[model samples]
Target: MNYQLNINWPDFIKNYWQKRPLLIKQGFTNFIDPISANDLAGLAMEDEVDSRLVSFQNGSWNVTHGPFDSYDQLAKTGWSLLVQAVNHWHYPSTALIAPFRVLSDWRIDDLMVSYSVPAGGVGPHIDQYDVFIIQGLGRRHWRVGEKIALKQHCPHPDLLQVEPFAAIIDKQLEPGDILYIPPGFPHEGYSIETSLNYSVGFRSPTSRELFSSFADYLIANDLGNYHYSDPDIATRDNPAMILPTELTEIQHIMQQLLAQPHIFNHWFGTFISQSRHELDIAPPEPSYTVEQVIQLLCQGNTLYKLNGLRTLNVADQYFVNGEQLISPKLNITAINILCEKQEIHADMLGNALNDKDFMQLVTKLINDGYWYFND
Candidate 1:
């Protein structure tokens, strides 16, 4: 399903995005659920899927991690089962993410689907990332509080929650309604009845995380090799005291490493292009040769990019799943089509199919489980 989002992008970006909370009623008009609750539960049973069960009962909060074998012991009410990165494994669920492409793809995280029984909730909590929660199938009452400093505690070792806050926007959300909450906002939702909710979250990396990753990259690539040298030795008042001039020089040396655009950009492109979740990759049992792929395309076969595969372009360079493709012979148009579109065909490739280097690259990607023929 191709889901259509109804919201003003410019106005929302200016007034609401990361600034406040909003309840966009009928954000997806007549929105049909892309994946069923049964399917979500099934995904939770998979070893690679990240999932959890959260319940509130007996005046206490409880949390359980999955690959759950059975739901037989679960409470009829006051429990919710959540599966993260459903988009990676479920093809239909990826449609839920396509509409949000108005935002940058790198910043978009994954689709988390939760099925809740009556009175089910995880308690009031504050998140550091922005999220859009879309109500599906059944009704759920949601409450969002203003973004303010709040004390946090955990009833369960795995669960972190915030103190209850005064509700600023409180309402029952029906199917297709969306609640957009930015970072630092305290929010809670409980199922009025059996319900399903799809949350599309965005990634917001902290400076510490970025620096840590960059530092690791620098070390791995043998960068920042320059050593500090003070040729002009002026005797200080105390030999133990490091001069301010020496400190400034040391900082400049560190800054110079980041100033190299080529190295920095390549590292960032490779780093950010990686998916945070495990992908459902099934490479062909018998991989097709370059000539075989060309013949298939020529025979009107369509190629679809693997769902949740990250293919990104950084300054004319293309990176897929954290690996850069070396293709000096490939044209920008071909690269753009490969990076931008989910569906690729002979018409889209055009004369690029005739390019030997480009054909070999495509064949490599296809065999590596990044892309596959629709057949």
Candidate 2:
């Protein structure tokens, strides 16, 4: 999990990152996978896991639902099994996400693992998010090209394909090698051998998505009460027809919402913390009352820590599970460490639990499996 940034981090962020794609050679050397292929397949069997099997047969693309029985059937030819959010389901695979912490943790998306057969590929496609594809067991030949017009690119129902272009970078990635691709770049990879690829992606929300999410957040928070109105009266024969002034007013309202102070930070933090689907968590068999939980903390019987949860501390506020907890007294250092560090040490829970409301909050988190304590 120790990542050494070869290139100047700040310079790359300011210059190339997202503006273009750059492949880092041996980004992680001697990196050992925490989970094996069998383990990954076991995870795919879970009902909560989102998985798909994509294969190229008879010169066409085919996809199937997974919880696959085995990869042996598809091992010889072109096929791949992809599982999303592997970190949420398996602790071992979660280590794959650790190296990218050099960048902002808030921007780090889920880790997607794909197991492919020899010569397997998903075809040339443009991704919306920045991704680092790390080779695990075998080799993968990757061809990457610069961003081009979608009109020039041909599309398939199952895959977004582009006309073949000369690869700016054509290379075979071996074990521990990494290929980083920024958004809008047309790239493709074919497995040279039976292989597993780990994709660590970064979040990149579109302008429309951002505006819509901000509006949703405003509605949820009961903020931005301004109703749309056009002072200039305009009547049309068709009442259902929308007027241009009304359209202008709506646009103004959107702009006003975007201008609010600390709005982006608030919205982004909440959006990131909120899980798209419920995480797999096993709460304590017998839940304790809030008072009992508080008493346990006071008595030092157990240590309470956030369970498989990532939190964001923004502007003296703590956010998790779309809920915000603000406290000037809460140690920023402790909060940062809690967010970054996988586990909270026994000592760190003392001050946080002293506040009755905070203690109750923590207790609720425990009951909800967002936090847990050991006896």
Candidate with maximal lDDT: 1
Model 2: residues with Cα > 4 Å off, grouped in runs: 1-8, 69-75, 150-156, 218-225, 228-251, 262-268, 288-308, 326-333, 349-357, 373-375
Best by TM-score: 1
For all predicted structures, in order, the TM-scores are 0.97, 0.83
- Listing every candidate in turn, what is its Cα RMSD in Å to the true structure after a full C-alpha superposition? 1.2, 4.0
lDDT of 2 by residue, 1-375 (tens): 444434567876787788877777777778676667788788788788888888888787877777666665764688888888888877666667765778876678788888888988888888888998988888899999978775434333556677777789899999888888889888999999989999988877687876788878888888888877666678799999997778888888878867765786787778767765447776787886878876765666654344336677666567886777554355555556555566555466657656655556556667877666656
Clashes of 1: 0
- lDDT for position 19 in model 1: 97
- lDDT for each residue of candidate 1 in 72-188, tens digit (9 for 90 to 100): 998889999999999999988889999897897888989999999999989899999999999998999999999889999999999999998999999999999999999999999
Task: Note the residue pairs that clash in candidate 1.
Answer: none
* Candidate 1 residue spans exceeding 4 A from truth: none
In order, the Cα lDDT scores of the candidates are 0.91, 0.74
Q: For model 2, what is the C-alpha lDDT against the true structure? A: 0.74
